[model samples]
Target: MNALRAACLALALVFCCTPPAWGEGFALNEWSARGVALANGLVGRADDVSTLAYNAAGITRLPGTHVMGGLAFIAPSGSVETRRADGTRSTAAKPNTWTAPHAYISHQLNDTVWLGMGVFSRFGLGNSYSGNWPGRYNMYDVGVQTISFVPTLALKLNEMFSVSAGLDIMHGHMYLGTKIPTVAAGTFRRFDNDMQLEGDGWGVGAHLGLHMRLNEQWSVGLSYKSQVTMHLTGDVKFDWHGDNLARRQAHLPEARDCDAEATLQLPDSLALGVAFKPLDNLSFEAGATWTRWSTYNALNIYMKDYDAISNKEWRDGWNFNASVEYRPLDWWALRAGFFYETPVVNEDYADFIVPTNGRKTLSLGMGFTWNNWALDLAYAHVWVNSTDYGSTGASGIRNIGITGGRSKNVSADICMFSLSYAF
Candidate 1:
């Protein structure tokens, strides 16, 4: 590759591999205000445009043509404090708030068929620390984002059962910044130099869903989202700080156009849910989701001159969620939900890049409908379990020359709003 292309490739890879803000693992669940209010347990009660994301098969419950749009605001707060062997301490800065948006449209085709499409961010993360933070060697900052477009078709076999399938087209981007450690001249101590990389890529996947109405008041749903592997090509560059400890002169020439490619596999997921409606205006649902996080054991980067792999060793994890909806008036509804998720990363692999562990979330929402237009709003809070990364752990920066640390007070607040119109 040319010098310019190589430099871009290197930087892109660094960007693509940073930590993102979302669920316990890397999965993103804020597709719509309704979905967030229900903790994403809408598989069995997909009566609106949001069904295009949770369970396409539920589209059979909608009438005419429906369109919906949503936006989510996420604010993450926490601190990673490094406790050196001698008892000194240092802390990393918190990340800023971020926004994720989504849109969906669906049309009922005759009595037995429906067509729909959805566009949204399926996964993302971003975090940053002070330039001179103690954990700079491990990570300074990272940002990664992904978007997916899914066109779906739902087939109603009968009044009680339906099936749906969709084609997934996804795009992604990444940027990473960090300080590389270098030995000081005439001394054994190490100093830091800045490094940055960025890149973008595309991938394809599939979505499948099934919905079954067992009785007038009970329903069950199942859905699967396939994994997508993004192959990103980008350039890299590094600044040597103009220090020449070896020759008491200028540092080595800047490295540019270092061509590289990284293959990132987004996890596959399966969700099952049951919904109950005992009264005319009240409905409830309980659901579980399983994500194949183990597939992301490492990040493999291929460069023209060499190759590298960042070990992750993530394990599969499960999420349990429950939600309730009450509609006392034809134009108004209330919603609430709760969920718990297990951590995918162990202390062995935990670091400043992704300090998340197990967590629980609670959500509240309200809706208003008039004529063919509707508005929905929701708020959610996530409580994260704190963890300590001591020097004795086999994983983390301690094993790779960076000081060990602990992540505490890790949590996030989310707000979402959606508007829907029917024709």
Candidate 2:
């Protein structure tokens, strides 16, 4: 009991202090170092406590209590270039590093039941550009952070099948900053005011999982997560950059700070995987995940006597991965994997907030086990296809000026480390 309490406290502190970086459409897949090294191919091979986040039903395979904790470090880089009749200009996103933390515990009870708990991030994003960039009117800075807690119960229906259900309790935080233009004395100025919105909220959902041992050498797994909605209430503040005379002559009214509210509809996902073990020292797995991103159709913010609306029109996305593990010795394992994610954002609704397209990742790592302790380490590099923006004339957001730009050289690097103990 004391150990459980301590683990919970540590997870909470880490989540509160660190923000997660961008992943595939802001969805994080680095819940465990082994999962990262395998490109999240563990859905069918959930042999560790980290399975709490992937497929809780797999916990039925364990006989004793198991605990695992880990952190993922992410660094992303990209640049946006705008071409206009006047000239060509390029601006790069500010350098930044972000971290995502995860923890899980699973215990088997009796012969047919298992209990598990996990704390991790499912969705998050952080991006910042120069304040005076060409796309400043669209977005200068933006960040979204979320953490989820899941307590699950798994029941073995028979020797060949196991099923699990869990509740998802999540907390979310958001921040957005943009430049507002003003017309002063019949002259149009690029920017004269700054607007920032900050908010936090809580949401609840559920998930289910199934694991099937078809034969001695083959197994299958399936998992599903329900959609969640968060209603955020926060403050919107505007800072006037123009002098008194300019402010008075401006055509736009001087807006006052006010309380605001918004609703965010997170997506639901389904994953399926198959694993094959041909040899005692080698195993392979393949998996795919589908996300219902269409649920995120729009972004709306309501305030006193004002309203802001943006049309997202995002489409569903998919991720496919394959992984292999080779254990040359009884105490060490080598792992390699790769995954590709389809684009979710429509070109017609492209914005500066998420500046990439379809992405691919390659990863490799190693794990060591000694007695009751295990250590895992992994590294991955992400490559994002260059995306062209501004041709659609639709800036997604109403009243925001269109800055035709092309986002290129977008990429990221991730490092993961974790420790686990079994009793």
Candidate 3:
């Protein structure tokens, strides 16, 4: 029991400090190199162990025991310039880059059954701004990361149909920092307000999938992942640092700790896809995904000493993808894909910390196979649309005159590499 407690404490500390990068609207689609190259169209054409992630039912196609490991590097660049009421502007530097890795293993029990497990990152983000920025009151830095463990079972009932289900156990972590205004002798001045919250929780969800083979040349897939609500409990530390006069005037304590808790509602998603093979060595796939992002409209922070809310005002979104692959030689294959994602946040809800926008991506990749070992490499370039932030912003509390925003541009590049083995 003592060792278990110690291990739990260590994990909480690690969760509070690590940083990871996620894409716009807190979505991560790059699970494997082959999936990335196909723009995540694998819902109907799962040819490897990674299929356990997109559509477990496809696992029936695996003939034996298989294992896969992969890594994704996300490099993002953007600039946010805050415009004060006085017409002055301040530009925030780019945030740090992020890298995520994933692994999966699957075993075929017989002609009708298969089992698999996977560990991977599903969502993550990090943004930190320099001091003295006009929008410091809204946010100076923030980070969030979510990791998941999934166990799946697949059943092949007949030659043309299959079904699968998986259980998702997700662990999440979050951190936030900002500066508040201090009042002294009827004068308003800037003061540092640093707060750190550390915690971990378990959320349960499920994935269901159906794969149908219409004929030898055509197939379609349908899949759904249930939403999860995580209740996270932890400790919160709030510290106020400034001149003695400022601290005294604000009537605040130097530092304090309190019990904290929050509820995080993750979105549920649905996907539909079709695959076609026109030649012995060529294949194409197209798919679409719909996410109920509107469910994540707020992050309500509850503490024994204080309460706060972060409004997201997000909307549902759709993603479209198309991809093709051709094998010119017995040992090598080439692939290319295109994808487009609708915006989830509008100008009024956009913030420096969670800069969201619509985007389009182009991807290219290649794979090589030798005996039971295969290697895949892929690259994607994302183009983001420019956005303007003004009076309509989500930063301020209930209601206040203090509003600071700006125009912004965000773009990113992703590279993924994976190795798989079948025995």
Best by TM-score: 1
Off by over 4 Å in 2: 1-21, 183-191, 241-251, 305-308, 394-403
In candidate 3, residue 348 scores what lDDT?
A: 68
Candidate 3 residue-wise lDDT at 361: 87
Residue 296 accuracy (lDDT) in model 3: 74
- List model 2 lDDT by residue over 41-132, tens digit each: 88999788999899888999988899999999989998988766677788998998888899999998889999999999998877888888
Give RMSD to native, each candidate.
3.8, 8.2, 6.2
Per-model TM values vs. the true structure:
0.90, 0.89, 0.87
For 1-423, candidate 1 gives per-residue lDDT tens digits of 243233344334345545547687766889999899989879888777898899889988888999999899999888887776666565745669888899999999899999999998888887888877877655678777789999999999999999999988999877777665555445555656677777789999999999999998999999999999888876565665344434422322232325568898889999999999999899999999999999988777677766656667779999999999999899999999999999887566566767677889999999999999999999999998775676334322674455566787888999999999999
Q: Which lDDT values do the candidates have, in the order given?
A: 0.79, 0.79, 0.73
Q: Which model is ahead, 2 or 3, in terms of TM-score?
A: 2
Superposition error at 319 for model 1 (Å): 0.6
Give candidate 1 misplaced runs (Cα > 4 Å): 1-17, 90-92, 183-191, 239-257, 391-396, 399-403
Of 2 and 3, the candidate ahead on lDDT is: 2
Best by lDDT: 1
The residue pairs that clash in candidate 3, if any, are none
